[model samples]
Target: MAPDQTNSADVLIAPAPGPGALRHRLEEAILGDIASGRLAPGTALPPSRTLADALGISRWVVTEAYGHLVGKGVLEARTGSATRVAAVAPVAVPDGAARRVAPAPRLERAPDRATHDLAPGVPDLRHVPRDAWLRAAREALAGATNQDLGAQPPAGHPAARAAVATHLRRSRIVSGPDDAVVLTRGAADGMSRIAAALATAGHTHLLVEDPSWAALRDAAAAAGLTPVPVPVDDAGISPGRLRAEAARTGARAALLTPAHQFPLGAALPDERRAALLDWAREVDGLLIEDDYDAEFRYDRRPVPALQGLDPDRVLLLGSTSKTLAPAFGIGWMVVPQRWRAPVLDVSVRRGPAPGPATLDQLTLARFVGDGAYARYLRAARARYARRRAALLTALERELPGARIGGIAAGMHVTVDLAGVRVGPAGAGGDDAAVVDGRDGVDAAAADFAALDAAAVVREGAARDVALVDLRRYQAAPSARSTVLVVGYGNLADARLPAAIRGLRAAVEAASAEAAGAGAGAARAGPTGAAAGSVG
Candidate 1:
């Protein structure tokens, strides 16, 4: 097929979440961009790496964010060309399983007290300025304008669009000020809108990271876009693999986290990023950039965005959710010049932002307009940086001799049990003391995976940093082995020290048992299959 006639679904792409369960915050971000013209309908988007860098986040975060918008019909994906903002309303999502929220698991009563809630992906609510939020809300209500009282455009408030544009330019480096902003409630809304728009253009299967964000993969599946899991390494996804996958799946785009990959914390290398972009160009697919948690760099310098490398080929996405708080739910997209119309059309279909919330827009505008956004980011970077240090310190104190990974930037990091040799379940080469009398097998894997492995982790005798195994990040058919992802964002300062200690204790116990088991295993054979597996 000629490149122009290439089917959007021909190159494989990601999807979005259920339209109903998505919060208005996502709509606010996606529609806001469409309204402000940051992503013109029919315009191309930057690769996910570009968007991630520009916004200081992992590409997966941006991918999910974009998926939310796509499901809502705000953006369109054209085959072999680019993902574009739609000028029309996206097709309504049928009410389905994806729309329903899952009931929270019943709380398991007190286990060991470990305050490091670094189970990966949980945002740090510690820094949320509740008072500031309340103040902004009250002020908005008190100063309600006529616009605030009435039903508004689905594209959100004009003021919000402007504010977002400014924010994008200031923080995310989104070009096309007048044509570069849209308001969505959060990243999810943005993804839905984008998915819906893409579906309109007949886009289908999406390519996501092998060990990608689960919510995003779910989001795309809900959006009716088939999801294809792509493998990723420390340097991020293999560009060559993406090309082959896209070609095989006939997908319209590839959803990626280039800046800092989700669980592995793999930053997409420049050559790999360029290769991905070239692949998209090759197959007529676009790249959905998910910029998640790029603000808090604990070690090395921050990486540049892939969008800056090639703006037109990538969909640049950003949000205030991570930099601020999740509920703040604000993000924007910078689109190419092609699909602007379809994007606008999708906006109109979502039905005006409820109440137009003029004041919020005003305040947001003022915040970014006054350069507070940058300052806030700087502060957040510093704060998270320190938290990383504290967490690291605590880990050293608690789970000494642990293998820490992905600590260079972002709110989350990885914990590889390969070194510490001790874990909660005694799977990590534990000693003889903590044996459960079950033939002295290392119990770390069984222990960690036993207690509803999906749940948060706890340390034992020989513990580790608070973390959820890397399998949580698996979006592919293949299940990855053991690796823990610990997030510092949600962990409180006061609780961090103790959490580390608890982690240490857990690992100690687990390690003891693991050591006992290892002796058992070594006495037996080499088939004890262990970590280093990517989900």
Candidate 2:
């Protein structure tokens, strides 16, 4: 409280007890008196010194309480005037007495949340640097002028664009901050803009990786372009296959997550990266590089963005979604000089553009500029590395025979079933029994190898493990059998073992069913063998 401030009444009475400090209690008591009409409107509160004397409390406490009441309009104080209650007083809503209304009928229901969340594409949210973000926000707020609160450009904040450009230069080696980078909501938002820009540039067909991120495919379709699926292997998007697909479909635009392929987690090798850029140049095509989580590479040196090699043909898209948090919704697009005007024009006029508030952009700029972003990345990278190690260890010990790839980086690793087929149910006891080494079955042996991925997913879900079918990521099925994409980010290090165990049980059940069917067929003899020999 300020030195000049004081309560006015000659005598004061304390009220019933409540939570918080003495000052808060006094404020609540005074408000209660006014609410109950014990202290009427225009009733003067006691002088701070006098009230402190009467109540055996500090004068400063009384002074502070009165000041708080004055600020709330519960009490009015002015220079050389008595502090009195306002014409009206606020009534506290009693607990458990708030009016209840019937909940509206559900329209669209949310899916059941999994206990062990192994779903892909999400990072470990537990390690978000809240303190650093808050500090950056405060700094941005302190430095901001009145103009910063005003209407922002459709391309986003100038400072933010510059910050992002600086970041890309250091990380991806992309060009200037000047009219090169456009702010967006995230990678999805950037892709949507790129899709529209491609359409505007008269490109009808876009080449996309088989087993690509679903959002990229959806964005292309939403922009009225045909997404031709080009197969991706362990080397990332296959150069030969992508070229063939582009040639066959006459696709002039290709969207790729080259640094770290989604779901599969393959970092596009340098040779393939060069091939992609060459194909783009030869076809006069556009490459939209979604560099979502490139910073989280656990093994090998960082692969710079493909856009850095051919900025004219490649459009780089990046976001805080994977790095900082998805809720931030701040992203950027590094576009070719020729495409900038059209992209900006579409961004301003068309929909799904940058919705991140001006303040957030400023905060993000401050965060990146002050090196808080880099520090946060370093911390997150280490944490994820440990988690990934734990996941790999558990998978090796429990699942054994599963061929895991995409483990060198990213949050998920692809667990390939290595040509194992799900046998029919009649010949087996249960897949779990087989996988547990019951009935003289070796879990790593050939019989346990070819279990149904779909059944594993279903059984895993039943066992409280959220399993995503790897085929969902595939554009078309290849020779590899029953690949399961296990996302280790969401699951805690402790829960990983249990989740893997549940998954093992599911696979085992599948194997047992296959074995049971095989045994039943064998018992049915030469007739059964003749019947099974089809085509």
Candidate 3:
């Protein structure tokens, strides 16, 4: 058998080589072509003689390149057969295209393999009511009609919306008709939809809490709305600051977590809630309330949804992510009548409705309607209460000087390190500057001047105890104090004692080092000279 004649027009287009041996360059060119899909699998290559002649290189160069590629299984060369491309080739990924094709950026870090995981924003997934969920799913499938199985309206199934409305009215005092509700995949999805509507309505800016949920802030940015940060104190976001920010930025929309604020954990007081409502009405602005984890208050009664005060101006968002399980993918947005049409239009424009499956939505409807949801919450609340108590007891014993902020409602508590002396007395009052956006803000720099929360996180990790620094959630740095948002929901009761002990060791080590540095600085005056020395 004779080798096929190499046609010039059919020759593989190898990229021009630079600064390498001839054989190596040829090998790289061939591999590059295969990786870029220019050389399709099973496609025959030109004879070594023909390629060498065309490229004005020695035939040995081409032969060596082919031999090298064959060794790597990138090309198949059988005796008496053409050297064709291999059947399985490397996937083609153009330069700078990996970011575009990467999965959605994780809002939070992946859970560590630490024995004690105090990562915030995660619920106790072990407690998921599998039996109840299976029952609800079976009932949903059994009763689903032809219409129910079909594509539902972008707003959601009528029954699912009504069930959600009823749950809100009964549990959170948020009164609204069924039509006012819009189902979503989660609270993050709801925020994205609302942000789209606001952007479409010619709104350019969104007011967000300084140290708020990074996911919701990203959602607003993804919809082309700039998020303006308003500082949050112990009592959540201040209405006065919010109003002033709204006036300054001309932002007509604000995303808040009034019912147990994220990370900080402050439930907005009634007067502040009313003031916020007044601000919304006065500016004709919209308030996006993220009602995450409001059902697990351990100390006192759960704060009612802020939407209850002024449903027309406030958009209430809630999800089963915390109450049931994030796997449920069930969330609701009680849209004000004025914003419903625009939000629905944005949802439709974004392609299929942003929600769970029809069957899943129906299952949720049945789950909420049959009172199983309430019963589950009661059990979860009790379990979480016990966990919270154990955590509080341990924190008190281990970190006695640390001030815990936020309400006792949510799954996490904020450990304020400002009061815990990392340096000499009166050496930690310097305020850090705030920056816009969520990423690349250094916790060590943006947190309280004298304490390094990042150091604590590192030391904690070394002790096999996971920790999250609060500055990670800040859209803008807080000047108040450094905080650790420690979540106890996912941490098992048995692990609490050891976890606190390990955490305490880390804090002590980091604090001692910081204090030493502070003392050295004090001994050596401001100009790095010996104290009381003249230049």
Candidate 3, overall lDDT? 0.78
Global CA lDDT computed for model 1: 0.61
Q: Please, what is the whole-model Cα lDDT of each candidate in the order they appear?
A: 0.61, 0.73, 0.78
TM-scores of the candidates in the order shown: 0.66, 0.72, 0.71
**Candidate 2 residue-wise lDDT, 255-372, digit = tens:** 8888888777787778888888888788877888888788887776567888878789889888988786676888889989888998888888854335478889999999999998
In terms of lDDT, the best-performing candidate is 3
lDDT of 1 by residue, 1-535 (tens): 1223333222212222324423343344445444544434564555555444333445676566666767767666556745556667453432331232222333563343233466665555545554455565666566668856677655556666776666555555556645555566666666766776777888889888888887667766777888888888778899778777877989868788888898788888788987888887777667878887765565665666676666767776667677777666666666655655666677778765622255666567656655666776777788778778888876665554556777478888787644443345323344423222232343443332222122225343124345566776775333334356777777666556666666555555444544545555554444544343333
Candidate 1: worst-modelled 10 consecutive residues by lDDT: 7-16
Model 2 residue 485 CA deviation (Å) reads: 0.6
Q: Write the per-residue lDDT of candidate 3 for residues 401-492, one digit (tens) a residue.
A: 57887777889998876555322221222321112111122333222225577778988998888999888898765553357999987776
Ranked by TM-score, top first: 2, 3, 1
Residue 24 displacement in candidate 3 (angstroms): 54
Q: Model 2: residues >4 Å from true position, as ranges? A: 1-113, 351-353, 419-450, 476-481, 517-535
Model 2 backbone overlap count: 18
